[model samples]
Target: MFKRLLLTLAFSSSIIWFGSCAQKSQTTADQIEKAKEQHAAVVEQTQQQQKLLEEKTRKLQEENQQLQAQLQRLQEEKRELEKQKAQIAKIQKFQNVKAENLQSAQCEINPDLGVPLNPPQAKPGECFAIGYLPAKYKYEKVKVLVDAGGEKVITTPPKYKVVPKKILVREESKKIVVIPPVYKTVTEKVLVRPATTKKVVVRPAKYKWVTEKVLVEPAKKVWKRGRSFLTHAVATRFDPNTGDILCLVEVPPKYKYIKKKVMVEPPVVKEVPVPPVYKTITKKVLVKPAQTKEVVIPAVYKTVYVKELVEPAKVQKIKIPPKYDYVTKRVKVRDEQFLWVKVLCKDNMTKDAIIKLQKALKSKGYYRGPIDGIYGPLTQEAVVNFQKDNDIPITPGAVTLKTLQLLGIK
Candidate 1:
């Protein structure tokens, strides 16, 4: 009985140990499942956090790119501004140089005069002693130095002057006697024959016969029957209607010679005429006698006288005086003078003033350079050109007030 009890106690101890071990294993399994659930929740939270961070990073990169683009645009604008500034500066420098040149040109001195002088003036109706004339004389009372030598009168003796005496003297006066011309008509025979012509005969035309050869028949093509032998015995036949055979033979064309008569040419004859003519005329002869009549004449005589010069005339030399008168005159002492006047010079010129000048020049089609406020060489040249075209005098390199006014610039 004691031995049986000890065996029961050992069996109970073994049962309790197995029960404890089973309980410990169940607890371990439950803890493992809970740990797996917690791990899955932590992984999900980490993935969400990572996605948010990536989105933030993407936005930052976009912002950075935008900032960079803005920076580049600003940089380009800055470069353009710098280029424009450089251009403006260059133009201004050129304008300044041109202004200096103009000033120098205006200050040039005249070659003839050591110093500037005012021009001479002239007044109308001004008199001046031109020259003098020699003393003049007039025709004073002209007196005869010595009476012309007296002329002596020659007196003729008192002899009887033979006067013209016409005496009726008896003289035979001759008279022309006229006799009528006598013409005797003589009869004479002259031949006046008419022209005559004779006719001629012409022979008839004649012709000769000529012999020639002519063709009787023309060349033609003809077909004839022929035979052909073949290695194999074949039937040979002739086409009665078409005259066609295995081989055709050519027939020669036939022709005949013919004679013909032709006329070559004919001969001709002509006739001519001969003529004769004659004429007759008549004439007359003349015979005559003439006589004269008698007339009377008379005698004639004439008388003459002698002459002598009485008182004679004479000539003498005389003097005359020249006329004189007073008149007004005008004279020029000097030419007009050009005086230097104050103007807009380089020292006093400003960008604004230069711009105004440039604009004015441009309006007149003088300044083609840039309108930037800089007064460059081009601007100076424009001013010069403007002055020259307008007939305005250029004063060295100065922008004279006159020039400004002409250009419509203040």
Candidate 2:
């Protein structure tokens, strides 16, 4: 009864240990699956973000192209405006200077320098500069007969020519002559793209996984006991080397198989010859020479003059009258004026805004310094020049809104 109980106890202990081991293995598998799920989610999110970035970049490029086109049109308009402003300035240049040695009867306004005479009537939120109204003219063509028809007399002159006779030379003469060369077309080859030898892997280095046995534990000798079959007694020996029944015991070497790679062939390089290309061409060659031939002569005549009526004798009417044309004359319509204008100054701008402003000015060929996002002397000067060139209100040390509009920045 006790032996049976001992076997039952040993079996129960083994079952409990095996159940715990299986639960641990199941937990490890679940962790591995969870890790795989997390990795996949991360990969998907990365791809989505990349796509978003690409879309944004494409949209930015399209916007940039549109801005460039708009800038081009603005620059063209600015140039035209600059031309008109220059003409106006030229015409109105005398407004700022007073006349010298003038009598009171010749002048209608006072010569005082404090206020300008006949200034332009400016409206609210509007600016004005000194500009002259160019002269206007109306053209008229007068129809006055320059030439009147009258009778005319014509006369014919006489003509004459001289004649000559040719005498016959010796009999017929023979002369040697050379003939031009002839040509025939032929086909030939020409190398357009040169022939070159290149390295190629004719037989690449090959490898294969081969199973090989490796020794883990080597063979070793150990002492063992010998038992008597009749008495069933344990044999006790003092010296392991000296025993009553000498037995040889050995543990065979343990071996294991593992996959390994073995090279089958090595890489190779070979030189190969390439054939040259050909093309057909036409050429000239000497085919025949000049031969002697007979010649013939003919009579020649001299020039002569003959009396002929080249033009009929008739009367044509002719008359002379007055000539007339229309001429243009300038007539002043309005006087130059001066007024105040609005502009951008240091109070309403930041570094980022300045950077964008600088870029716009640079693209329009107004600014030449680096885009350092600084409202420095270079930027201010560029703004003034741009404003002047585009016919915007040129307030010193400030940029007019009209200038920004012309630069396509607004």
Candidate 3:
């Protein structure tokens, strides 16, 4: 029995110890499961944090790209501004500048990346747009002249737009040498039209006057010879002379006048073609003169002939075609004399004296145009004609000192 109890106790002790160890092992397992859950939670949290950091990095990269683009645009704008600065100074001198015209503002190139540090602006502080305001410039000057004697006038300037205006024009004149007046002859062809002329004439017409002789049956009349058994002699008298001519040899005026016949011709009638006739009926209307006043507009031309400077300059080979000169009109512009006059042409003789020359003979209706210090046909003819008609020496075309006295020229 004692042996049995010991064995039983040992078994019981073994059971207690085993039960305790089993409880301890279960606790340890629980601790291990908790630790594993903790480790898993840490790993998950680390992955979530890493994902967030990667998103932030990607956003930062996008922002950096935007910034780089903005920097590039800014650099371009700066270059443009510097280029236009010089031209702006020159233009400023001609036009007034407003305070607002120079307003500057920074432009933000990208809006999606973040709130713009600077906004895109037309009137930016950094630069001006050459497209809106021209970088290159040009200058011109105009003259405003006032009359020395005139009403004092106030002037108000007008504003101008950028549209180009045509250049002003002016004209210049110069004196030129020309020939003088002289009588000349020319041949011309003439055409003549026949004119109608009317005339009338009277002529004798065919007619007859007859006188009849009386036969023996004639009535008796007392005669110097008394009644004769035969016929009495008929007498005819001449119209101017009353002398009678015996006409038994040819029966005389005692005979009776017989019927006379005359032949007639029909009057000539000709048909004529007449021109169309027009008639005028008066009506009230405004009448204009045959000639109208002419407005003499002065000739206009340019003075400045500026040539453009071209890039990659090239010389243009302009082939000018040959041209011809034309004479628009022939006018007596000048008349002069440089020779001595004949003595008999005017008065006393001299060696070197200016006679009644064309250029200087205005008092006697001679001379034409400027005296260009020469003698020509027009001057010589005037002197010759004056001498010939005035009963002076009729020298052909020579001027001697003697002719100078009468002309009052020395």
Candidate 2 has an lDDT of 0.52
Instruction: Give TM per candidate.
Output: 0.26, 0.24, 0.23
Candidate 3 residue lDDT tens string, 1-410: 99667555655664576468557644654454456556557657866786787688658855765665556556655765665575445334312322123122115222442323332352322322110112222333322221122232222222222222235554543322121112234444332223433433344455565555444345443323312233554543333453433232322334554555545553344445434323232222324322212334345532222223233423333333332222122222322111111222222222222333543454676655345434455565565556544544333334534444567766
lDDT of each: 0.49, 0.52, 0.40
Q: What is the C-alpha RMSD of each candidate to the true structure, in Å?
A: 74.0, 43.3, 68.5
The digit string of per-residue lDDT tens for model 2 on 270-329 reads 877665533343333446532223323223332222233444544444442333323232
Error of 1 at 350 (Å): 21
Residue 338: error of model 2 in Å?
Answer: 27
Best by lDDT: 2
Identify the superior model by TM-score, candidate 1 or candidate 3. 1
Q: Write the per-residue lDDT of candidate 1 for residues 1-410, one digit (tens) a residue.
A: 99667545655664575457546644643454455546557657866786787688658855765665556556655765675576446434434444344344424545352324321242343211101111122223322222122332322222222223344434544442222234566766544333545544354445555555555555543434455453232345678787656433333455555455444544344434444433232344566532122323223222222223333433333332322222222222333224444466454578888889888889889989999987666876787677656655444355767788887776
- Runs in model 3 deviating more than 4 A are 93-410
lDDT of 1 at 94: 33
Best candidate (score: TM-score): 1
Candidate 3, residue 225: the lDDT equals 30
